[model samples]
Target: MATTASSAVTASLTSVTLEVADPDAAHRFYSAFGVDTRIHLRASETPSSGFRGFALALTVSGPATVDAFVDAAVAAGATVLKPAAKSMWGYGGVVQAPDGTIWKVATSAKKDNGPATREIDETVLLLGVADVKATKEFYVGQGLTVARSFGGKYTEFAAGPSSPVKLALYKHRGLAKDLGVAADGSGSHRIALGGTGSAFTDPDGFVWEA
Candidate 1:
């Protein structure tokens, strides 16, 4: 659905809405990060119903930063889904956020290379949508320029070079394969965002918080 307003829109996401049983508690737990978040309380949802389809990726420049960041996250109620260490991709680890969302914190230092600086870098929101083409079109229709895209597999968008975070989309099964999870994601999408786009849900159920 295109409109004159859609064409004129200049959008950037401000939050990821999550459906939770307790908004206050989830808010308290997620408040540790600077990223603004929204919570929706729904009693009908199963324990696994919310936020099972995506991962938040945080990147730093080296190992020590990754460890410290992850350590702090764990201390702030996040649980280690995967221990921090050097992986083929880089130095990083996985943690389950308080709202059941998964987070992957890593350094740019790849296992094949040597050391990089210890400075923390960027935090990116990665969404796993059921239909990449449709999802990409939805955001594009809302006036967010895609930074990069790989056929129908992935897409990234951010505000120029200064924004510390970026939004991305990927094919649902492809993302799940990397996380070693089932691809058939369901239940209350439990997430939302505010930006240029009209309110809508991608094929897999991730909702736009606006």
Candidate 2:
């Protein structure tokens, strides 16, 4: 018997993130596709001597090429927050996403004696809201369980396995307002905030994580 003309349906796939105002919306869309999620804590609360900052750990081919890529990202869709500049310790620059998440792109400052190389880096995304409880519930219903709870005023939900992108909720007026900075939906830049995690603001006037 001759095989029928049953052509396989092949589609080009380019995976990109969806930036939605409501976390619940994002959760529902991804969950329907059966996507797994996981949360990763900061590499360390007390980073090593040369660990620098844990904002966004994107490893680029070289420091010079970092800014060019960041610029391209901005031109494509990302919102450029901090222009690419050589960090204090050396390496690359930090840029912000349209959703206000920082992207720290850089090359390895440590010596590479072995063939082992790093590819994908971790980036911690901050989700801000007026009410912490309400926000947490929104993520929960979407199938993302709280991986870490700060108790005081923050909780993180995992996005995917091995990805350190955190969905955090924080108080609006606690740190940003306290610093005498007005909320313009993106907060007043980023603050170390005296902790293992970095500080970030949301599109709204709410504080959370980076």
Candidate 3:
């Protein structure tokens, strides 16, 4: 029998590369933020403004770890988008990196179980799409299994064991509101996704490559 698209693993995101104007400065910021190993950087002069239609989220073990990352990022020249605090979902904060990447460091646990640690539980690349349902279907057709979905609002894909980052979808304007930015942008996304399949662009213009 022919393998079904849902059962076949055609694409698996393995790495996230951000194109920045200054890789050296970005490297210094990421190193101080303690996530230098989780992402790749490249030099580019793409003219992008407002919201970039995406955000990189760091899931940590507890509130303490979230605070640790937020503090370090702020100390490394990152601008605070949202101050870390307890919310209905958990504790987290948002920061804009020097390279213009928005990062959200969060934890489901409302309280710390122990001292803060540098360990990151998961790294999620959230793409803001014009149509969540359509984009979800496009990725499903690309052989990415849906790990979780909420009607037409949001969807999360199961990352393969070897993949370094998880993928998720959110509505464009909603994502901008969540990230505390205006939903207006032009030019390149300045981001590339390294994956396990042939190169393709998603409905929202996210580029993925093998």
TM-score of each: 0.74, 0.36, 0.94
Clashing pairs in 1: 17-191, 17-192, 18-190, 19-190, 192-209, 193-209
lDDT of 3 at 142: 80
lDDT of 3 by residue, 98-127 (tens): 999999999999988899998999999999
**Higher-scoring candidate on TM-score, 1 or 2:** 1
Q: By TM-score, how accurate is candidate 2?
A: 0.36
Ranked by TM-score, top first = 3, 1, 2
TM-score winner: 3
Runs off by more than 4 Å, candidate 1: 1-9, 31-51, 110-120, 160-164
What local distance difference test score does each model get? Answer: 0.66, 0.41, 0.90
* Model 1 accuracy (lDDT, Cα): 0.66
- Residue 76 displacement (Å), model 2: 7.3
Expressed as tens digits, the lDDT of each residue in 1-210 for candidate 2 is: 111122221211111243234445335432331121412112112212211112333554555556555665566455554555555555655554433334556655533333433333433444435666676665454344565666546665544543334445555544233222333332232222211233433234333333
lDDT of 3: 0.90
Backbone Cα, N, C clashes tallied per candidate? 6, 1, 0
Best candidate according to lDDT: 3
